[model samples]
Target: MTDPSVVHAPAPAPDRIGRLGAGVRGLMQHAEEAAGLAQRPGLLQGLDPRAKVAGAFALILAAVATRSLLVLLALFVLATALAAASQISPARLARQVWIVVLGFTGMIALPALILVPGTPVLSLPFGLAITEQGLRAAAFLTGRSETTATLALALVLTTPWPQVLKALRCLGVPRAAVMILGMTHRYIFVLADLALDLFEARRSRLVGRLSPAEARRLATGIAGALFERALALSSEVHLAMIARGWRGEVHLIDDFRFRPRDGGALVLAAAILAGTVWAGSVWP
Candidate 1:
């Protein structure tokens, strides 16, 4: 005799659960790696975040101002050297910075190769031709993007998030902007963890593989629930922060001092920028 009270549920799908687990673990591992990198006793890591932020900005400006491909290449090399000095692996930079910048910039530059007018370098079907001017323009665009991204990534990887935010505040960025950036950064991780929890709970409760329509509905529901939870969490967090007397100002245990090394780094960055500008002007 079958028990009327008993309910049968289908077995859970292994693949879906495995993918969710892997994605969450990968994200957490990446965050941990970034934190570890910032703590390393490397050249950039030792310098004050203020100096690093300034230097990175100067380098990025140099990249943007330079028209010569050679100058951009030089900046990219300098960025790579700085990354090496900061104990950041080339593979990590390639995976995190280079690949992303190149992929995005490449798509934008591809159309320019056929659209811009100049001496024809290559002919293609559909009355398309790659021109010298177009090729140069595309190279310039892609190289500049890659150089700037490298410099920015180096700064981010070497500096802790809190210190970076504090450095921005010290550099005369508006207090409101700094506060927003800090809160956003902190909340991102908090929300990520919350999302992971939600996914896990859903996975546990899931009985079997969902049909395409069922999957879409489930995803939509999850998204709506996540948004609602995030709103409530933000409110509670704001109240808790107020209770703890957190004003709009950011504070850290170690106050930044402009050491001699930081001064030297700033000087070096200025010299590099000057040299790059000169090279760009003289390049035929």
Candidate 2:
């Protein structure tokens, strides 16, 4: 009784390896998309990475220093608008970073919502009460966290990873820390590729279903194999670096120069920061 014009969806893959492969691929796709977006002609994409880095950190510090909800909300809105101007979808940007911001903030702020002494706003079943002061404190804390995260995410999304690290070094970050960050970023992709290849190879050889014990055995095997592979790869990478005459220090070609446009950007950043600080003083 199936209609010839209608098509049915394929059955879901039953193997956990297959699902894991799909998940890895999805993550890789998102990373690639974000990198691609960085290359696109946009407001922040054209700016100097060093300026962007300084400006982003400046805004984040201001957000953390202030307790005024209005200032925090304004900063969040400013970040959203900047994303839009950069041709990045605000909703998509929020999706990528909001979980980290909201989830962590909620966990830390939730205690404040009931524990702090203030006028009772709501009475709960277990003799717990939400106070107005507690609610206000929670809102302020949450807003600050979200605003800081938003600004940080926007900077990362708009700048290339290499440029970001380089900018960090230019901004006086420790060479060891920058080197570690560079290697970590590089190895993340290497590990992801290794994982996807192994998972796909297993998936291709897998039959319809694996027994529970068989699946567990395969999972253990994959984990051990990947660990071994990582160690081997790290050794090879270190050897190659040494072969290239790498010393204890890393050097990147410094191309960042503070131009007139960058100066203008810095002025704007300072103005925003001043406003935020002043708002905190006036409001508090």
**What are the C-alpha RMSDs, in order, of all predicted structures?**
5.9, 2.9
Whole-model lDDT per candidate: 0.88, 0.85
Compare the candidates by lDDT and give the number of the best one. Answer: 1
lDDT of 2: 0.85
TM-scores for the candidates: 0.91, 0.91
lDDT of 1 by residue, 1-284 (tens): 99999998988655544476568778888889999999999999999899999999999999999878888988999999999999998998999989998999999999999999999999999989999999999999999888888888899889999899989988999999998998898888887788788788888898767776887687678779989999999999999998999877779999999999999999999998998889989993
Q: List the residue pairs that clash in candidate 2.
A: none
Q: What digit string (tens of lDDT, one per residue) describes model 2 on residues 1-284?
A: 87999988998666777777888899899889889989999989888998999898888888888768888888888888888889888688668777778888899999998999999989998999999999999898888877777777778888988899888988899988988888898898889899999998888888678987998899899989999999999999989988998653546576676788988887899888888889999987
Off by over 4 Å in 1: 1-18
Error of 2 at 53 (Å): 0.4
